[model samples]
Target chain A: MSDSPITSGMTGKTFRVGDFLLKEWEPGEEERIVAAFNRVFAKADPNFRPRSLDFWRWQYLDNPSGKLLIHAEAPDGSVAAHHGFINQRLLLEGRPSLCGQMVDSMVDPAYRRGLQRVSLSATLSNSFIGHTGGEGARLHAFYWGAPVPVAMRIGKALVQYEVVRTQLKLSCAPAEVRLQGASGISVEEPASFPEDTVEFFRKVAHCYKAIAVRDQPQLDWRFVRHPECRFSIATARLGGELRGYAVYSHGSFDGFEEGLVCDWLVHPDDGAAANALWAWLVEKARASSAERLTAVFPETVPDWIRFQEAGFRAAPTQYPFVARTCVRRFDPPWLRRNWYYTLGDTDLV
Target chain B: MHSRHPPPSRTLAIEIRPLQKGDEASLLEALNAHRGGCVQQGHALSSEELAWFLAHPSGTRTLLAWEEKEIVGHLSAARHTMWMKGRQVLFAELLGGFVAISHRARLGKRGLFARLCREFFSEQGIDGDFIYYGWPTREEWRLGRKLLAYETIRTQVALTLSVGNAAEGLPAEVELMERFDHQARWLWDRCAAKFGASAIRDEGFLNHRFVERPGYDYENFGVRDDDGVLRGYAVFRKGQWGEETKGLICDWLVPTDEPEVGRLLLRALEAHGRTQGVQQLFCLLPEWSPWFDSFQRAGFLATDAERMWIARTSARRFDVFWLRTQWFSTLADTLIV
Candidate 1:
C-alpha cells in the first residue's frame, strides 16, 4: 500500500505535497479513487451509493471532450484528496474556446482535520489551477455554477474566482398566465428542430458576447439525448422563417403539478417571436393541467423582462455564477451584464 | 376593536369582524371579484379549493372589513408552528390581504391596513411568543413596513442554472426514487440542529406538505448508500418557467457535514431533468445556506432580483440580524408559493 508505480493509459505529471503524492489520475486507479470517495462521503450521507466503474469511465474516458482528474494520495497509498475538471467548448462571441468545468472535488476527512504546514485543500486546488494551462492542459477559463461558500472562499483566495451573475427563478400559475398576441408569428411543437432552426440559433448566438454553441449536434445532444429527462421543443416561425424556439416540459414541484420552460432562444430583435413562443407554452401547460410553470434566467439577460411581461413572479432564491480566466482580462462590470446565460447552460436541472 | 371613521359622503357603515362560518360564500365571491380585476389568466378557485385554507389544520382566521352585508376588504391570518432557536413557537402568517377596488380609496384614507395590522397583532397577546409575518408584494411590503412596523428578514434569492450542456450523468450507485420511505422520518432529526430556525420537518409535516398536497405531483429523490440507507433527499417538480421546461427542487435535506450529498442529489436531479428534457434547474435557498458551495459547484448562479422574508414579532422587539441569521425559510415553507 506504499507509494508505488501504478500503470495508466494516460501519462500524467506528478507533484509532491508533504508526505502525500499528488498527480493526475491513472487508468488503474478508478477503484481506489471510488473507494476514497465512498469512505469520505458515505457516513456523511447515508444514501450515498458507491459509484460504478463504468460510470467513472464514462465520465472521465468516454466524454466527448475528455476530462482532467487529479488525485492526492497519502504515504500509505490511500487517496487524500481528489480534484478534477471536465472539458467544455464555449463560444465567446461566435469564437470557440476551451473551458474547464470543475467537478468531483473531495478531501479525505482525516487530512482535513486541522490547518498544518501543508494544507491539502489549498495544495490540491493550486495543483489543478496551476496545471490548467500548462503542457497538455489548454483550458482558457474555469467556470463553476452554484459553488458553496466554502469553495467560493477557497477559489477566491487561491485563484481570483469572480462572481459573474445570479440565476433568477421566476414562476407563475399556468392558468394565470395570459398570452398576448404576436402578430404574424405561429408556434409549433416539433419533434426535432429543422435545419433552419439550427441556423437561426447560430445567428442569434452571435448577438451575445458569451453563449453556449447551440448548433445541430450540440442541440441534439443537449435536448434530445439527455439521459434522464424528455423535453418538448416548440419553434416559432413567421412567414415560414424560423424566428425563435423554446424547450419545455411538465412535472411537479412541492407536490403541485408544474410546467417548466427550460431553454428559450429567439432572434435578438424579434420581440414578437419571443412573446409568441412564451404564450404558446403557457397554453400548452394549461391544457396539460399544470398548476404552475417556472423558469430560471439570468437577471442581466433580456429575457427576464420578457418573462415578467408574461406574468412570471420571482422566487426568493438565487445562485451566483463564478469563473476564473487564464487567458484574458475584461471589464468585470461589462461582462457581468452582457453575458447570455439560461437554465440550459447550467447542469442543475 | 372596530374603529368608526367619519363617513365620507356615503352612509355605508363598515363593520369589521372575524370571519364566520357562513362567510365562505361571500368571501369567495369577494376573492374572485378581486382576482378577476387583478389577475389576467388564472381562474377563480372553486369553493372546495378555498375551503382547504379555511379548514387548514393550522387554524385560519380572516378579518373581513364589511360594508353592511357586502365584504369590502379581506385579510387572513393562519397559525403555524415554527422551530426557532431550538424551540417550537406559534406564529401567524397574513395571507390574501386585499381591499375591494370600490373601497380602495376609502380604505386607504381610513388606514384600513393599519387597523388590520393592529387587530391581528392585538389578537396575539404577550402570553405567547407569536410572530406575525407576511410575504407581501412590493407595494404591500412598503405599506406593511410603514404601518405595521414589520422588519425585513433575509431576502431569499432564487438560484438558477442552465442544465443544457451541463453534465446530466449521475453515478450508477445512487438510486433516485420518486417517494419517501420510513428512513426519511429521521432525516429532519439528523439535520435540524444546523437549521437554527425552520419548519419542523417530521414525517407528518413531509406527508402533509408534499405527499398529501392537492393537485400537485411532487417527486422525491432519496439518495441511499450501497446498503440502502438514506443519506439525503430532495423534492422537486418539472414545470414551465416562461417558454422553457424547468426542474424546480423545492425542498432539500442533507446533513450539513456531508455537503457532497447535496451535490450528488443535484447531479442526479440533472440526470432526471435530462430525461424530461428540462432545459434548466432552479432551487430556492437562503443567501447563507450551508450547501451554497454544493449549489455553486453544480453550476447554479445568483440572480439580481431577490424576494424578502419579512416579519413582526408580537411578543417583543427583536433584532433584524438575529432574525435573518436564525430564520430558515424557503418557498415551500409558505402557502403562497
Candidate 2:
C-alpha cells in the first residue's frame, strides 16, 4: 500500500484510479455520475445523514424536469463522484431565483490523487445559434457545513453559540372570512394581473433595487401558485382605460406567531384610493371570520405600516446558513460589471 | 477501501410477536418486574414517552429476545411512509435501540440487525439512479464508517419550530364578520393589484391545510379610516390551538407606511378575543420570513426552531415547492433565542 495520497495515473497524466482517462463530467454522464455519487455515499453515510439516495436522485437526477449529472472518473473510467444540480426552478416575489442542488456528491477516498470537482447542468441551453436561453442555475451554495476556517491559529473556531428558537403562533379568533360593509364600488372578479400594475409598482419604488421584474410570466407564476390566498381587487376606470387598481391577497400563517396578512398590494400610491379599497376588503375579512391578514413584505415599502394598520402583526422564519468554497483559486473580475449575471442574483439560484 | 471482517462468534435470534389484546396488563407487570431488577444503566425510558413512541406510525417494529424460555432483551424500531425527496419513500429508524448487556459481547447488535435487515431492510435501491452517499456527522457518522461498504455524502441540519397558543390568543377589540361577496372580492382584488392576482384566497388552497372551512373564530376583521376608507384588515382561520378556536391569521393588510401600524394592527388583534370567544392566535413562520423579530417585539413568545431538510425522489431543484413537515421544534412565543 502506498503511504502517499497520490495514486498512479495513466494516459500520460498523473490523475488515475487505475487506467481510465480522467475528464470533467458532462451531460452524457448523468447515469454514471449519479451512480458514482450514490455509491460513494453508500460507502460513507447510510443513516440518511444529509439525505437518502432516493432523496438525492429525486432532487437531482430523476427530477421530472431532467438534469445533467457530473462525474469524475478513474483512469480505468470508473465513476467517482456525482455532483451538481438536478434541475432549475423559479422563486417568485423577487429575483430570478435559479437553484442547483448537490446530490450524491462524494468521492472514492482511496482513489484520491487530485480532481474532486464534478458538475452537471440541465437541458437548458445558454445559447443556440445566436439566441440567449435565459439560464437560471448556479453551483455556489452547498448543503454541508461551512468551509474549514482560514487559519489554524484562529483557535479551532471557539465561539459560544446558542440555538435559535422557532415558533408558530395562531390567532385566537375564528378565521372565517366575512365582509361587513356595503360600498358603492362596483366589484369585478379579479382578473389575471395586467402589466400596468407592475408599472404602477415601479412608479413608487424601483422593484426593491433588484433585477427589474418587467414581465408577465414571473408575476403570474409567483402569486398565482398559492391559490388559497384571497384577493380583493377594485378597478378604477380612467377615460375608459383602466389607469389604476388595487389588489389584496388573502394570506395566512399557521403555527408561527399568529396567522398574518401574508401579502397585499395597492397600485397608485394615492392614499385615498388604496385606503378605500383596503376598507372594503378589510370589512369583508372582518365579516368572513378571519383572525388576521397575512402578507410577505420586504424591508422597504409601507407594507409593514399598512399591514399593522390593517390589524396584522409581523412574523419571522429562520434558516441555518452554511457556506463552502469549491474553487481552488477564486477571482471574480469578469463578473464585477455584469450586475445581472454577476452579483445581482437571488438565493434560490 | 479496506474491509474489516470479524469472525462470527455469536448467533442472534429475534422474534417478532403480535401484541396480545390484553398485553397492557402484562406489559405493566413486566415493567414493574424490571423496576427492582438490574436493567442496563441509562436505558430506562419513561412510560409516557414509551407509550408516545409506540403510538406513532414509525414505532411499529418491536423485537423480543428469548434464550431457551427466558425473555432477555428486545429491540424497537419504527416504519414510516411519507412524502420525501418529492416522492413517497419508506423510512426505517432504529429508535430505542437497545440490547441486553449479557448479550453485548456475543454479537447481539450484529445478530439483531442481520435478523431485522432480513425482515424489513433491503440493500438494492435506486433514486432515478444508483446512489451510495454517506456522511460523517457526529451523530450518524459512525454507522457509515462501521458499514465500510458505504461512501460519504453531504451533511445537513434537520430543523423545526412548534406551533401553539400565545399567553393571549385573541385581541380584546376583535370582532368577527361575515364574508361580504363583493367586499371580500374587492379586498381580494386590492390585494391582488397591490400584491398580485395570485394572492387571493381560494377554497382549494385553504382547505388543503385542514379538514374544513368557515370553522374558525375571529373569522375576519376590518380597520377603516375615519372617513370610511378601508385602511386595514385581518382574517383568521381555525387551526391546532393550545386552547380554544385558534385564530390562524390568514390575511392582514393596511394602507400605511410605518412599522407601528403593523404593531397597532397587532394590538387590535390582541384585543380581538371578545369577538371570537377564544383564547389564542396561531400561525407558522417559515425561515425565509422577515417579520420574526417583529413578532418577538410584539410579545409573541417563540416556541422552537429546528433545521430543515428535504428528501427528493426525483431530479428537481428545491425552491419553495418543498413544504416539509418537521416535529420537535423548541419554538415558543417568548424565547428570544
Which one is best on TM-score? Answer: 1
Candidate 1 off by > 4 Å: A1-12, A25-35, A49-66, A74-78, A113-115, A133-138, A148-160, A182-198, A250-258, A283-289, A331-334, B1-337
Listed per model in order, the count of residue pairs whose N, CA or C atoms clash below 3 Å is 78, 211
- Writing each residue's lDDT as its tens digit, candidate 2 over B1-337 gives 6559865655555454433444434443444444311111123434543454355432345544445544444434433433333344333333323334555554333554344423433331433211112112223223222322321111122111123344554443343445433344354344333220122333222222122222223355665445544445555554433323454555554433435546656655555533444455554343223344456445454332111222211222321122212211111110111
- The candidate 1 chain A region of ten consecutive residues with least summed lDDT is A1-10
State the C-alpha lDDT per candidate.
Answer: 0.65, 0.34
Cα lDDT tens digits, model 1, B1-337, are 7659754655677788888979889988888877721111155756765765665555666788888889877777666667777667776676747776676554442466556655656766434437777665544654555566665554445667777765557666567565566677677778777776777666556665667665556777777777787888887778643344568777888887887777778778888777777777877666556665457545576554334567776544343445555566655566653
lDDT of 1 by residue, A1-349 (tens): 0111112212366887677787888779989998888788786679887766765675566544446778888888989888766555556656655455566777888888423665686787676666564222235444555555556556655555655443347677876565767899988887776777557866787777766555554555567766556788888999998888888878643234578777889866787898788788888787777777878766667677567656675643434466765544432334455567666665554
**CA shift of B60, model 1, Å:** 47
TM-score against truth, every candidate: 0.47, 0.30
DockQ result, candidate 1 = 0.05
Give candidate 2's error at residue A144 in angstroms.
Answer: 6.8
Q: Pick the candidate with the highest DockQ.
A: 2
Q: Fraction of true inter-chain Cα contacts (below 8 Å) kept per model?
A: 0.10, 0.13
Q: Chain A only: give the TM-score of model 2.
A: 0.39
